[model samples]
Target: MGTQERKALEKQLRRSQILDAARMLLFSSGIDSVSISGISSKAELGVGTIYFYFKNKDEIFAALQEEGLALLYSKICKFIEKEPAPEKQLAGIAEAYYRVSEENKDYFDIINYFLSSPRIFFEPGLKYQIDMSGHKILKIIQNTIATGIETGVFKEAQPGRFSIMFWGTLHGLLHFKKLEHTILENENHRDLYEYSVNKLIDAIRCQ
Candidate 1:
């Protein structure tokens, strides 16, 4: 590779190293507990190097959140591409979400942390980017519902509103995983999730 391209690749690798460290710290500890020094230690990089890539812990955290959301959006798109039916597309979207939580727990935790905490402040630009990332994902869901409606497979309903409710319900149901051994003892969480998804599909199906 050319000198300029090699240097660019190296810079990107360094940034990934720092972000990976910060993600680990965010998942193991809490966001408030993550620090540049801790990330540098976790990454085995110099503090100066960490600062070279990120302005502060908040910046690093924001980067992680943005990266996680983008990854989710990409995964959802891939899942949708693999399914031809709108009903199957919605199910694929739900499965993709669950797989991300199971397989990419670090990203899921970082995204969930910011989403569940409304008190946290983000710069307007960063906030808008994050909001747009989420909106894009929701748009896919909304459009899928609209497609189903257009084909006469789904009952007439407001796609935009139903999309929000659908996503919110799935997200809320996922959180119940923490209660599996307590309130949900003897219940299969996956079964519950699938049941919820099916019921939502049934609700909009033209009878």
Candidate 2:
């Protein structure tokens, strides 16, 4: 192996170690309890070594949250790849969203933590950088909406705006479950998810 390649690979490995440690600490101890020393201890590295990779706990958590978003985006992309029709794609994306949440509840909580925080909404530059991963997922939704409009499966509307509505509704439903509030108490949980997604589709469909 080339000397420079080896160094780069080693650096990446160290960063991954720090992130893994931080993720464990954040989940086990809550984000407010995470600290440089805590991560260093968890990672079995010197505090100074962790500093070399991340500036603070927030930075480390932000990186971890980005990974979670990337997971969701990848799932959406995979579902979209298998479905050509826009309506079907939308349904697939909704199912994929819930499927990821069901499988990675902790990761989903990390995402919601970053998203619902006022800091991201108040700070434009920080919001942009942190939301980039989410924007990728949103772009997929926007494209599906645009395609639906073109195919006359959906009513004429701004794709971006509708994308927000679609995503926000799904997030709200997921949030209810996270909060332990049984809005869909009588119905099977997955049934409620399908019901909500179908409702969104019906609302957007050309009548």
Candidate 3:
């Protein structure tokens, strides 16, 4: 390989290394607890080196949040690929959402942080990118509902609002379970997610 290519590859690797360290710190401790020095310690790199890659911890947080959303968007798109049946497509999408929470708990926490503090995305270009990534994910749900309506499976109504209702319901349940309260504790705790999905499907279906 040429010297230029080697240098470019190394630069990308270094950036990824820094980002990975920041992600670990953010997940282990809340975003408020993550600092440049802490990230440096966790990354085994000097504080100056971290600053060289990221202007500050906020920049790193934005980058990590963007990456998490992009990954989630990709996963849902892959799951929904070319399925003509809208109901089945929604089932897959719902399952994908549950899988993300179950499998990528760290990313999930980062997303929760993002939702709690949306003002962080106010930076001009960053907000656009983050919003576009989120829009893509939401489009999957909206499109599924639109298709279901066309096929007479879903009740005819506003697709956008229906999509929000579906997503909001699931989001509410997921966050509720995250609380320390024992109200959600039961033998079938794990099954609450499936129950939510089934109830949502029933609610949206044509009567």
How many backbone overlaps does candidate 2 show? 0
TM per prediction:
0.92, 0.87, 0.84
lDDT of 1 by residue, 1-207 (tens): 999999999999999999988888887998778788899999999999998988878788778888888888888999999998999999999988888888988888778889878775577877887788799999999999999999998999999999999998888888899999999999999999999999999999888
Instruction: List lDDT for all candidates, in order.
Output: 0.89, 0.85, 0.79
Per-candidate clash tally: 0, 0, 0
Which residue pairs clash in candidate 2?
Answer: none
* Model 3 spans > 4 angstroms off: 1-8, 117-124, 179-181
lDDT of 3 by residue, 1-207 (tens): 999999999889888888889988877887789899999988888999998988888789888878878777777777888566788788777777777777887776677778766456447777787778778878889989998999899888788988888777776667776653476555354577787788888777888
Q: By TM-score, highest first, what's the ranking?
A: 1, 2, 3
The positional error of residue 171 in candidate 1, measured at the CA in angstroms, is: 1.1
